[model samples]
Target: MIVTASSITFITPQVATARAFYERYFDTWSPFDCGWYVLVRLGKEPDAPEIGFMEPRDGAEPFRAGGMLNLTVDDVDHMHARMSSAGETIVIPLADNPWGHRGFGVIDPAGVVVYCHKAIPASDAFAPFIQKGPDVPRGA
Candidate 1:
């Protein structure tokens, strides 16, 4: 099966807050605000990933905790500085990972963990696990 597009929808009481957070932090995203629901697209391309925020429906459980969203950026350090200066909560301080990334984690207003990172050379321990392929898309 070939996958075309993807999105993640979060049920939260603070739909507006979540939408505002994405709008403020992720500059490239465009939002489709619809009162109780907000769909934020990552880029101008039609196939760009989207994140949806919606008010919990009757008997539906709102997202409380225990999930994370990984967002790769061009410059993790710059983003870290921007978020820091904005007084955003940095739950995990920026650090290098053996799996080939320099990243940090921030908790959104809706309690979702957004792990922001940039690619870095993998450590020796993880290098063998890293794979390259012809079908893999190149250049973010």
Candidate 2:
């Protein structure tokens, strides 16, 4: 099946705070707004995911640390610089990983981790242990 659209909603008690944090950090504006449920579209394309936040319903499991919102970016260094200068919470400073990515991480207002990264070739020291793939996507 073709995936037409997508979104990842974080259930948190800090709805307004989460919305404001995403707006400030990602430069997004909400197109759909509900007091405890907010949706912020991140891209100009029609199919872009509408990242949102919702309040945990009664009897629902309490918020728990699970997955992260990983954003594949064109320039991790640039993002790191902007995030650093803006004084956002840098959970992980910029660095290359064994998985062949150059990236950084930040903690949002709700304490969820947001990782932004750009693909890169693994360093020679780490190359043998890692699988290789196209360093850049074709036609990118």
Give the alpha-carbon lDDT of every model: 0.86, 0.78
Worst 10 residues of 1 by lDDT: 131-140
Q: What lDDT does model 2 reach?
A: 0.78
- TM-score, cand. 1: 0.89
Question: What's each prediction's TM-score?
Answer: 0.89, 0.77
All predictions: root-mean-square deviation over Cα? 3.7, 4.6
Error of 2 at 88 (Å): 2.3
Q: Which stretches of candidate 1 lie over 4 Å from their true place?
A: 28-31, 134-140
Clashing pairs in 1: none
- Candidate 2 clashing pairs, residues 3+ apart or interchain: none
Model 2 TM-score on a 0 to 1 scale: 0.77
lDDT per residue for candidate 2 within 37-118, as digits (tens), equals: 8888776666666788888887655357767789887778888898889888898879988768889989876668889999
